[model samples]
Target chain A: MTTRRSVLMGTALAAVSGLALSAGLAPATAAEKELNIGFVGVTSGPAAAWGTSNVRSMQVRADWLNELGGVKIGDDTYKINIVTFDDQKDPKRAIAGMEKMAQEGIHYVVGPNVDDGAAAVRPVAESKGIIYFPYAFPKELYTKPASNAVLGMIANYQSAPAIYKYLKENKGVKKVAFIAANESDPLSQRDGGVAAAKALGLEVVAQNDTYPNDTRDFTPVLTPIIRLKPDLLVLSGVSPGNAPLLIRAARELGYTGLISTETAHDAAVLKEGAGELADGFISVGGASTPAIRSKTMDEFIARYTKKFGEYNDESNTKVYALDYIIETLKANPKAINDVAEFKKTVDTFGAPNPYVKEGTLKYVGTTSFGQKRQLSVPMVVTQYKDGAFETLFVGEVD
Target chain B: MEQVIANGLYLGAQYALIALGLTLIFALMNVLNFAHGQMYVLGGFVTYTIYGQLGLPFVLALACSALTLAIVGALVEKFLFRPVIKRSAREESTMLLAAAIAFLMDAIILILFGEKQRGVPKIINGVFVSDSLVMPYDRILVGVIAIAMIASFMAYMQYSRTGRAMRALAQDRVAAQLMGVNVDRYSMIGFALGALLAGVVGGLLVTITGVNSGIGGPISIKAFLMVMIGGAGVVGGAIAGGFILGMMESVGLNVLREFGDVTYLVIFVLLMVFLSLRPNGLMGKPWG
Candidate 1:
């Protein structure tokens, strides 16, 4: 019943009619809008794991939130989208990454993972009205006249003193020796730890023990430090790659004392590289321990590990940054485009913590940063066993 | 002080193993081989995959690492470096090719390995501590094994037919070719051997220090320092340079404890002064 010419004409006619109808009705119903958040950090270098974890946490939470029909803000509901840039752990690239986010009209951004990166993007963030959450611990970025940056996690200075005080009271630790990789990040953390250690009346021994970041053999580096026999040996801002090697070398050299760091570490890496050598290693654990995890947090961990093959322990703190961004925007929708309103809202902001089982989410650091520019993170210290983290204690930032 | 020597010995073993591979490629090809460290990283990952993930024996993992690197090295020379060396007017142009190869290998490694810090379980463990000398049993075993490998390589070079041919080619490429040697085939084999050495060292050291994609560049820079300290193409010089660096690090960190951040500065100045006095290093001749 159908001829070749007739079928061809009929197909052509249907195509034309469909296009005409869509074009004619295009003006009345508009396309839906989605919110964009940016992540600019070191995702391709030695410090890559932390930045990558930050992005994944942001993505996992954003994806989960979007599946819930998006978040309701004012009278409109919008889904979330993530933008990412790899700064390669360089400061110049970090500035460019910030400029790119600004070009895309993204108001809220997360990270420039290290100290120099966070500092380099400060000017761009201020001029472009972007609010950035960084893990770097620089007082100037959080201090007065610097209003756009917020601390995403606990600074080493804040955690070091708390850890040191607990050690002094419980473990009978009276003397301390500090060692850091001879780089800007670790050196800065070491200096802060030194000041904190001295303030707590703990004697400082062998504070000048620093090694080049590339040194594989800590034998020469740790030999002198071990001779001092300090009750506590503090590895300030040690990267995950170096942690196991350091612990192994120290233990091989007969170091019987306790070892600790302020940065979170991967328990699996510790087990594979250091084995029994890393038995008593202490580090900053997750932002929320198992005792404090909400149902949302458990679901997030399941989805993240499923998507990424494995999970980075540092994600415990990074998972909170995006949700806070969304929640604050919900509190005052005007802050979505205007950072001034966000600043005002941040001062009086108090909401139920989304990832934690209990307690309220609010900005602290009014005294430490001279503004409420830091997220109030639960400080959970953990000790490394075979291939797992056992919670040592949980304390809140003063 | 004795403990410092013990530490230096262990450190020297690692430095020597790393330097040998770089020096061999330089001697054979006159190529700067910037990608040598990436090959080393590839070797480490191969071993990690075999032993750490697949649950194979450590020896089999190491053997596969060596075999994989040798084939890769032979192919790279056949296609990439060999063609570039032929077409370029200046020998220094090979350095550009080497740099490009380094970038290529880095990208390849990143895609495959995913930038994770990978390691294997220790093959042997426990410490051997006596009278202020605290040496891990693994370090002692590794040092002995490295020394044996070096000695075996020397014997092979002195006796084996392929080794003699390769050495003769290094000494005089045109003359060796005229003496009925297959220049192209031997040259490719020589490069493969050099890369194989890198793989072997990487496999050995991965047990001690974890490996990742980001470590490749720094390892190359350190290899360059070792090669410079030694005579550019001399194998014996590489060994000497390794010991010298190891002892310097041990002494600099322990004896010169007060210098803190500036100890490396002092060491660098001393090295510069030494190099200024002897431009050819301890063993290099005028031409080499």
Candidate 2:
């Protein structure tokens, strides 16, 4: 035992034994440190596409993380689990879903895609001390400093100004007509657009507040606006189903003026709905066109399309949210149960940071939502051309 | 102004087609078929299945939808309505029955076709572009087809044996029964014709506006409004009401723009006025 050779042999045996012990305990450690994330949104109604895309993307992200030996936090690895509730786009159901998730011990949550659901679920989430990532557009949700919710998508304030600026600088748009569906979010979006257009010195020649969701013939709505002969026609905050039909109706009515929207509808859907008429239309989000997407975005889109049969703009938001959560967890592994620490970490890091390799997210906190919780990514104005959305401009708003 | 008129007239025609079905059912059965709009949506989906998914000719798809709905309508009358009619307390029971049918149809549609809006290729392309106005041929075609179908229906109701029997039943069911008219047979035929009209309109609307399952409720409301404004049991009144409502929407939106969403409020006001001043509606006869 005193010899140098004996000492080396004993040390080697101990190292091997330690390695075996760690290997034996790894499964138990992983089983003990499970993270549950909840998603509450419309998954079974007319707006099902939004929730379907959201859940599928999150699932894909979770699967990828689990495959890579789970999320690493200091010396521990935790398995990521995603639990979902379908709100069917109803506010009462959204609150019920949030309560159910809280009962299930989920502290992290995402979704309530539209305004009503988001508003209804906010207080419930805050009361439970849960971190909520909402895809809604209402600024009031984030205006309160003590709220546990952060907007995971672009706010109407940012989108409206960005869109108006693009139209003014690039298209030389002057007079504008605004139209939207007769829902709370759409109305809010229209008001934002009206204010933005006015602030930018564009005259709002015509505006319509109410178009029903099931409206098949937009001619009654579009004809009057076309008659106004404005330099720009704005269809803001309409559902994916209504947006394209509006475009087709406008084109059929023979208005060649510029058309734009801030709605994050899939360009492929717009193309399918409006066909060749979709060409020359401007919109936010870059899901439909190959020109604006990064290589990583392309791959994600390919995977998403293979799984979901289609790609939507909301998919990008879901992926970014998951990436941000994962990155934040990695930065402060001990922040898992500490809500304040997690919020501080997210607030300090901001966005547009490197997400999954080759992907970057930029979130800006605007005064519009009171606190800096809204995700403010650079606005990408895309024009549909030759059966694809061509990137026209990428710029930021004041 | 010309464009506004054209738009209103076309819209009116569509409303009339949908309302005519509701009026027929009310006239014949003394019960409102709340599921009428679901029938319209189902008709569109059936046409979409035939024309869009199966690669059939559009007209043939329309014909198939109309025929299918006619059979469905007859079955509904024979099985669902006939039993309730025998009970003879249609006010509450039939209302419940219609609502149940509506829910059943909506659930089935949601399960089958999904909530996505389905588009049908325009039967004809191009529009009549002028200095003052633009009109799509699809709109014009819908108007023409509706007018032709309504005219044909009026002729049938006035001349055919079944048509006379239906009118007699509408006037006095007991009297018609005494006159040896087949009440049960005419009721089934009335239901079939009503559903047939909805199917045809639904098929046409697919080409003009596209179709989704969500179209049922709003359409049902509008159809009901048209029936009430035009007079509950009067076909002519239903047509007039549909056109008036269409014109009001077009002109109101044109003049008021954003304020035009209150067009429905205007309709409601007019409805109240009509109820107070002319309770029987524009063309409805007194019950006595």
Summed over model 2, clashes come to 5
Please name the candidate that would achieve the greatest TM-score relative to the true structure: 1
Tell me the TM-score of each prediction against the true structure.
0.93, 0.85
Tens digit per residue, CA lDDT, model 1, B126-202: 88988878888888888888888887876776689988887877777788899999988988998898899888888
Please tell me the TM-score of chain B in candidate 2 relative to the true structure's chain B. 0.96
Off by over 4 Å in 1: A1-30, B285-288
lDDT of 2 by residue, B210-266 (tens): 777666767888898888888897888888888888888777666666674776667
| Model 1 CAPRI quality | medium
Report lDDT (CA) for all predictions: 0.85, 0.78
Lowest lDDT 10-residue stretch of candidate 1 chain A: A24-33
Clashes of each: 0, 5
Q: What is the C-alpha lDDT profile of model 2 across A1-398, one tens digit per residue?
A: 39999999999999999999998989966467778888998766457767766787888777777877888877877788899998988999999999998898887788888889998988888888777888887767777654577787666677778778777897799999998887788888888889999999999997664676656678877877787889999887877778779989899998899888886666656654677887888777633345545666677777767755556665654666676676676777656776677777765664444333223454456556545575545456677775566777765532
